[model samples]
Target: MPTRTASCTCGQLSIEVQGAPTGVGLCHCLACQQRTGSVFAALAGFAAPYQVTGSATEYVRTGDQGAKFIFRFCPVCGTNLFHTEDGITGRVSVAVGAFADPGFPAPQVSVYDCRRHPWVQLPPGAVAFKKDPP
Candidate 1:
């Protein structure tokens, strides 16, 4: 597997994913939009038993299902680094845009579609689920 390196836009924070992503998905919830300022947020989840260099700010939040999701990021660039959900993959979801690799595969599924804006058309080829994966 090809290890990948990524950092905050200002390069203040950096991380190395020793292998391929654990998965990828699109989240259309309001929180995701409020965080990314995009129509939706897509992240490349990776199970990297790695270290994070530089200080990061964190926001501990609970999802609709009450799963604790930790939002971690760089304080300098204000980039959203990763998110972790309880009892799922022990890995974090890394923003694909942060990766040096531009050929990042798009989301595999569309989550929180119930909250997706009607103005934005769903991206082709993604399984549109009303809620998160089961």
Candidate 2:
């Protein structure tokens, strides 16, 4: 895949990601829902060499598994752009919706299934976990 750009709602912050995503997944954790203000969050992971421009603010929080994560968002628009965990090295989970591309790849995994909305439907063959996979 070629390079793709993702921008915040106000277009004040953006990122240029090269190559294809290493992974794509959906998170149904309450923190994800609260952050995105939606039922869940769709994220695409990219390794190093990605370029981010403009300013962003970060919020750090602990997950159910006792791992800490930093959520980065556009300071101007408050658009959640990406996040990184303490244990995850050299990769970022970008908010798929921020790309504003309908043709973006579908999620390969669905996590925190226990918190997923009852009416939410996932891809037929997606790998799902009741909670974070071990």
Candidate 3:
């Protein structure tokens, strides 16, 4: 795994992922939509021990499990960079659009599908979940 550098649209915030992603996913939940102001959020969960540089504004929220999750973003550019939860085990799910190069890999699974807009269709055979996939 090579060290990869990622940044916000303006390069105000940067992150280094020292290894590959755990899994790539899509979230169709209302929270994600409202948070990102998008139809869906494309993300990649990566390994821990990453070196993050620059300033990030964080907002903490209690999730469905009553666990705290930190959502980090660049205040200047308003790009939601990553989200981390303890349950994810020291990993951060980086917004795919923020990746310097997300490349050929697309999301493996889609979560919060029940909240998905009716017009937003999933690829054939892609798993769709009403809530959390598991």
Best candidate, lDDT-wise?
A: 2
Residue 10 of model 1 has an lDDT of 92
Candidate 1, 1-134: lDDT as tens digits: 67787789999887777777767788898889999999888888888585688889999878888899888899988998777776776587888788867687767778998988889776578788888878
Q: What are the RMSDs of all candidates, in order?
A: 1.9, 1.1, 1.8
In order of TM-score, best first, we have: 2, 3, 1
Model 2 has an lDDT value of: 0.92
Candidate 3 clash pair list: none
Q: Write the per-residue lDDT of candidate 3 for residues 8-117, one digit (tens) a residue.
A: 88888988887778888888977889888999988888888887888999998786657788898888998788879856677887888887573736777899888889
Q: Which ten residues in a row have the lowest lDDT in candidate 1?
A: 81-90
Best by TM-score: 2
In candidate 3, which residue ranges exceed 4 Å CA deviation?
A: 86-89, 100-102
Q: What is the TM-score of each candidate against the true structure?
A: 0.88, 0.95, 0.88
Model 2: residue 41 alpha-carbon error in angstroms: 0.6
Candidates 2 and 3: which is better by lDDT?
2
Model 3 TM-score on a 0 to 1 scale? 0.88
Candidate 1 residue pairs in clash (backbone atoms < 3 Å): none
